[model samples]
Target: MSRPDRTHFAPLLRVIHWTMALLVLAMLFIGVGMVSTTGPAYVSLLALHRPLGIAILLLALVRLAIRLGTGAPPLPDDLPKPQKLAAKGSHGLLYAAMIGMPLIGWAMLSAADDRVSLSPSLALPAIMPHDLMLYWWLRQAHTVIGVAFFLLILLHLAAALMHGLIRRDGVWQSMTFGKIPGKRD
Candidate 1:
């Protein structure tokens, strides 16, 4: 049977969205910890960072597929053209970073001849040949991209707040839980 049209995202998509949100936030902090220490704690942080990055990469692929197949709800009609363009551009950048970050990290490690070890018995094969120069370059690019990704996230949060609070538009509710303020189920 055909289901009723959804004003919000599909349940599965919402679940993945929130789950990835937490994971990504944890990753950012873990990344900072990994870079800031060189002691016993660094070992623990690296252990967490590698596996978590792979998980994010895999989940991002699944999320992108679901998004493409199901599509998102339209933006509010009153949203300005510039804001609409920004929304589209930002989402594209978000997905790009979600998918690209891990790949770059893996390649960076690969160029350094390091294994992407997920566990004592499991590890991913290197995708790039050992080249210290290349590894150094990728490492710098990764840090720059990571900072840009974080800034993009902040902008995204501000936009969401604008929609949910100042604008009182349904755009924010489209991806959120519960019934929209005035809309019936």
Candidate 2:
């Protein structure tokens, strides 16, 4: 058999990438809905957020391992230096937020002396000591990071559209459209 094409991400990585994308978006909206309302539905959204955050964290760890081990396709050589740097920095920030956000949320819950339920019946052990001040700080940091994470996602989407549409570059296909049959004319 021939070697798998390197232009596209490995299939597992692609699956995880899209899966986490949907999950993260849902989590963000659920968080907003949770804060914007009152009563039973709000409580349910809060419950869902914790488990979804954990799922994103677990998937991110696997995605990071695959990224490091297999590596991503290189950006086009014609790409400008500033845009390339922004691409790299944005990607790094995305990964940092993906990994950090859940852990911060987990720690915040722990510091608040709350049991971190992975499910209605399952719970995670506290990674941080119970401290009201720590909980307050972590809560604030989580909010700030969540906003930054959303902004980074918007930037990432804009860059992807630039590569796929305006630039007609294969960078987007490296993660998305997969390998094409022939080289660009």
Candidate 3:
């Protein structure tokens, strides 16, 4: 049976949402720091980044599956059509990046003949054939997409805050702890 309409997200979904949000933000910053520094710390961050990217890739798959199987709370009726479309479009893009970035990273490393080891003892097989030119292009694409993803995240945060603070709409509450202020069905 389909899930009953509800204001707040399913508890598990909420947990996943918050968890992925934190992880994604951490990955973004870690990526920047990894690229900018040169030292022991950089090496440590690089090690951390590999496994974290894999984790995000796996989690994104789970999140997408759950999202597709469940219904989300509807947007507030007062929100304009254009705003609604923008919200939907941005969310779609976020999901795309969430899934694409990790795969790109994995393939890039494979193309560069680098190991995809998660831990000292746990190694992953190559995802793509080795090609220096492909590696270079993927690296550039990853960087550009990372920046765009970061900006999109900022836009999402701004919209959430607008709903939570200025608009006083229940949009934020649907995903947050606050009560659902209207009918769910």
Compared with the true structure, all predictions reach lDDT values of 0.88, 0.85, 0.88
- Which of the two, 1 or 2, has more TM-score? 1
Q: Candidate 2 — worst ten consecutive residues by lDDT sum?
A: 1-10
Q: Give candidate 1's error at residue 42 in angstroms.
A: 0.9
In the range 50-87, model 1's lDDT, one tens digit per residue, is 99999999999999988877778777778889998999
Shift in Å, residue 99, candidate 3? 0.8
lDDT digits (tens) for residues 1-185 of candidate 3: 12346666666777888999999999999999989988777999998999999999999999888878776777877899999899989989999999999999999999999998988898889988999999999999999999999999999999999998888777888787767555442
Q: What are the clashing pairs of model 1? A: none
Candidate 3 lands at a TM-score of 0.94
Better of 2 and 3 by TM-score: 3
**How many steric overlaps are in each model, in order?**
0, 0, 0
Q: What is the lDDT of residue 38 in candidate 1?
A: 76
Ranking by lDDT: 3, 1, 2
TM-score of each: 0.94, 0.92, 0.94
Pick out the ten consecutive residues of candidate 3 with the lowest summed lDDT.
1-10
How many clashes would you count in candidate 1?
A: 0
